[model samples]
Target: MNLVENLVVFAHGKESGPWGTKITHLAETARGRGFEVMSPDYSHTHDPRERVAQLLALAPTAKRLVLVGSSMGGYVSAQACATLKPQALFLMAPALYFTGWDEEPQGVPALCSVVHGWHDDIVPMERGLRFAKSNHATLHVLNSDHGLNDQLAALALLFGDFLDQVKTEIL
Candidate 1:
């Protein structure tokens, strides 16, 4: 895979910290592959809109960016994507059905990939599938739950593949 030097920002779920399991593992994986990853702590707010604002505020203005949003953070990332227009969007069990947030995203990144767990009770896989279909994003249905802890290996692989795809597309 070609090495990408873009700034990768990871947004954790509502109840998760910046150092959550998935984010931490992905950050390590990204770093090993020569990526600069940033996980901002948005554990303070459960509100998706507020978290979206927080993420947008922390987003870098000068470099290429890839936004990885998990669960509620997925919703936040999608919302932030309107403004940041990152090079790519990687979503994990994205919560696209939050009330009052009802607009199909516009100006999406060049590459959008969403991975949803088949066993996720918090946000059903069907919902994610519908969202992915609507947004025309590549979807990966893994055998896991809402937290997707059981599929870390698969997630890591997906993340790496996404980086390579983005790098290939941009370069």
Candidate 2:
């Protein structure tokens, strides 16, 4: 059997490695499903937009990139929205401006899932809903605050369980 060994978990602005959040749990959950997940240690506090081009420059080498992002990381994921053909696009509390490219998206791959906290103060879920519609991305909402960026809150948000939902769609 082939091992599905490619996953990238990106953190939001000023947030870094492992993030100690539900995304980490989600990554751990995915490991049982045969995935090798890596959370890139990008600067969360800085303007991570410029970091997108950097990620895109390396897209060709990734085997089956599952781009996961939160807040600023989500903005970075948007840059990949047009670069590599990801196996799945998972955005958890991502910013919407990444979808700001001037040209219409060439083709949106299947299995695009976005999870947003309903009470998110940083990025309004209302705007996020519109972005998802434009890209035909699936939206999963959590009834919490932006604090879901942390592991405990993320677990409470049931992000770990959502891994199955993502896997089911992929398989």
lDDT of each: 0.83, 0.62
Write model 2 residue lDDT over 11-116, tens digit each, in one string. Answer: 5544555455565666766676556776656653365656676567655334455777777677677667666777667777767654453333333556666777
The candidate that wins on lDDT is 1
Q: How many collisions per candidate?
A: 0, 8
* Residue 26's lDDT in candidate 1: 92
Consecutive 10-residue window with the lowest summed lDDT within model 1: 55-64
lDDT of 1 by residue, 1-171 (tens): 444357788888878888888999999877776678888888877777898888778755434588888998888888888898888899999888756876666667758999999899898898788878887889999989999988999999999988878767774
Stretches > 4 Å off in candidate 2: 1-5, 15-18, 60-63, 98-107, 149-171
In model 2, the Cα lDDT at residue 33 comes to: 57
In candidate 2, position 88 carries an lDDT of: 66
Candidate 2 local accuracy as lDDT? 0.62
